[model samples]
Target: MNLLVICKASTQIGFGHLIRSRTFVENAIEGNMNLDITLCIIGDSSLKLLLKNPAITFLFYEDENQILLTKSYDAIIFDTINFNKSVFDKIRFNAKKIISLSPVFNLMPFVDICFNRTQYWAEDIEKLTLKKYGGFEYALIQRNCNRIHSIIYKYGLEKRYFNIAISMGGGDAANKTLEVIKQIKNIIEPFTFWIMLGEGYSHSFDEIVNEIRKVKKHEIILAKTNHSMWNVLSNTSLLITTSGITSYEAAYAGLPTITFYDYDNQWFLLKELVDTKLTINGGKFSDNSINNLRNILTDLYHDRSVLYDMHKRSKKQFDNEAANRIINIIKEEVFKT
Candidate 1:
């Protein structure tokens, strides 16, 4: 089977979509060795570093149009949030079937299969075609999820400081990392902050380092790499992050999280995550958010039960084999005899 996987990643939009698409393709190939895959990412060449499959062909965003105009694929899987009707029409002309992942587009009628792990569109599920699937059972977790289990046990050993991890996605277009760090400085308690920076982070590292120096009462560790965040979250007592792939990963790792929505679409998914009772919603990113997060943090710090309850709920909700399930479903649906 010939498959075309499309997604986007950039410093402005972050890498969630690309990460999901890449993981999906990896899983798909592992499950079916005969499949020929071409991964088209709507971003620059730097984004190629995230994908490691030499067998799959990589195409930049600019070349997508020409590729679509020429060759055809057996199926096209779109993992991007940016859905354009015109582009969808173009893609349809070059593909036999269409499948969408993660955030759903309004143009669902044109899609043959859609998978949204969150309950954002639960109300519309019954009204859709038989191929539509939703809920955490279909969540596409990173491949490194299994590795974190042992790490979590290793880090579960006693520690002195309350470790809080702040990861605001790759781009952090709104620069919420600095704001979150600054507000946490107000807490007089003994806490250590781990700031996970992504490749797309365009903010001045020097500025964040200078801000870290100002905190005398607490310790701050700034992680500036594409390192496995699971390791960091394994040791972390609390997570301060945007409602993205990272939040779900933390949930699967049984780590409590305080989430903020950086984008408009994130707001809907955030609501569903809050419904799971695994995370506390910190609302949208804004000027007033600093004080709000600080207050939430202080409350969780005092009430250990709240965090522990969330931790327990997480283990009950998330499954590491969701990616395998999704891949199996795709093969069953698209490759039916």
Candidate 2:
């Protein structure tokens, strides 16, 4: 089966879509040995470093306008966004079946299957004729394939120390990590902050290092995005991140997260997740966000029971089989005889 995955990522756009699409491709190939996949990424070649699947073909384009679908495939999965009508039409004309991972409303009329994890699309789904799946059960979270280090750490909360992780998506274009760290400095608690910086972080490390220096009360650890995130998530008590795919990943890991967003869509998604009581809404990222973050951190610090309850509820919301379920549904729809 020939499958083409279209996704976009950059320093400005962040890498959530790219990572999600890659996860789908990885699981799809593993599920069916005969699956032939071509991943067409609308970003620079630097993004290729994120791909670990050697069995899948890779294609990169600097801009979405350059995409010309001259060849047809059995199915085309779009995890990209912000394309004009003409480009979407060309893509629709070239594919036998279409699946959408991004919440582009324009593609709903033509898509065979659409996956959205937010309830903001509930009304729209009823009006659309396509098969729509939502919630954490359909989240495309990447699996950590490395199990050799399983002996080194236990997969649960740490009672001796409070460990908080901050992972603001892959490209954190807004540099929210720096702002989040700056706010966390006000907290006088003796907790550890595990800061994970992505490969696309073009900001100054010296600034973050300098900020960490001022916070002498707490232990600060700086790490790159090279390690297995699932492992990091399993050990951390709370995650401070943008309201992106990472929040869903945290839910799957049963880690309570405090999420802030920069856009309206993310704000709505954060609200929906907060209603589930598995996540805390940190509001939009702005100049006044530091105060809110500090207060939330203080409250969670004084009362660890909130985090534990969130963890319990979060564990039941999602599972590890998200990739398999999504891929299997796509496979069934595409190959149905």
Candidate 3:
């Protein structure tokens, strides 16, 4: 089987879609699915550093019109933010099966299989012609999910100081990290803040250090773009992050997650989790709801039960074998052996 992983990753888009696609490709190779895969990410050359793999051939497309045309792939998988209708139509010209990963709101009606794993596919699935893999059962877990979650799964929040993490995706183009950190400083107590910055983060590391030095009551640990957030988050009691994969990872590690979304898909995820008591919804940051988010955070700090409920619900929300499920889908649906 020949497969094409078409996705997008940039400083502005962050790395959620790219990371998820990479995880699936990694699992496909490990499982020896008799697959020859090409991971085509539509982004700059910088993304190459983040997706280093010797087994899989990497193709990065920076030019808009230079989208690669494939002829013999058995299937093409899309985990992109915005794939034009013409581009999507062209990719499926020769492929037998077209599979889509969540968030699938935009590409739902256009694919053969909808790995409609999370909140994005729930509302209107009955209308789409795509074969479904809806609900949390198909939620993708990180390949290292077990090891990462084990760091603090059993004994949650075992760290020395009260640790709170602020992560607004890799690009954090909006620079919400400093805003979150500043609000936490007024809590009137000593706490440690671990700020995870992505490669696309525009601020200087020196400036972040200088800001922390002025307020010595709290310590700030900076985890650069390629840093292992799982390790840092495992020690944290709570995480204030963008509504992305990191929030899901935090929940698996048994940490209370508070989320702020910048896009439509993220808002969909926030609504789903918040309704389930799986996360504290800080609402969309783009709505100019910083004060509202602050008020929610303040209330959450005083309410440990709310956080704990979110933690327990988070663990139960996912099965952690999402990659394996996708592999089975390939064997059963695409290959049809």
How far residue 75's Cα lies from its native spot in candidate 2, in Å, is 1.5
lDDT of 2 by residue, 296-315 (tens): 88778778778877877775
- Whole-model lDDT per candidate: 0.76, 0.77, 0.72
Candidate ranking (TM-score, best to worst): 2, 1, 3
Candidate 1, after superposition: displacement of residue 177 in Å?
0.7
RMSD of each: 2.8, 3.0, 3.0
Clash list (residue pairs), candidate 3: none
Ranking by lDDT: 2, 1, 3
Residue-level lDDT of model 3, residues 1-337, one tens digit each, is 7888888888887888888888888876787757788888888898888876798888888953588684668788889757777767666776888888865446668778877556455456566777877666666656655533543543454443567778888887767877776566665455677888877887776766666667756787888746466666776778888888776666655677778877664466666667777677777775356666656655655655666566666766676677778868876887676
Off by over 4 Å in 3: 105-107, 119-126, 147-160, 204-210, 213-216, 263-265, 286-288, 292-306
Where model 2 places Cα greater than 4 Å from the true spot, the runs are 105-110, 122-127, 145-161, 335-337
lDDT tens string, model 1, 207-247? 89888888888899988757476766677788888888878
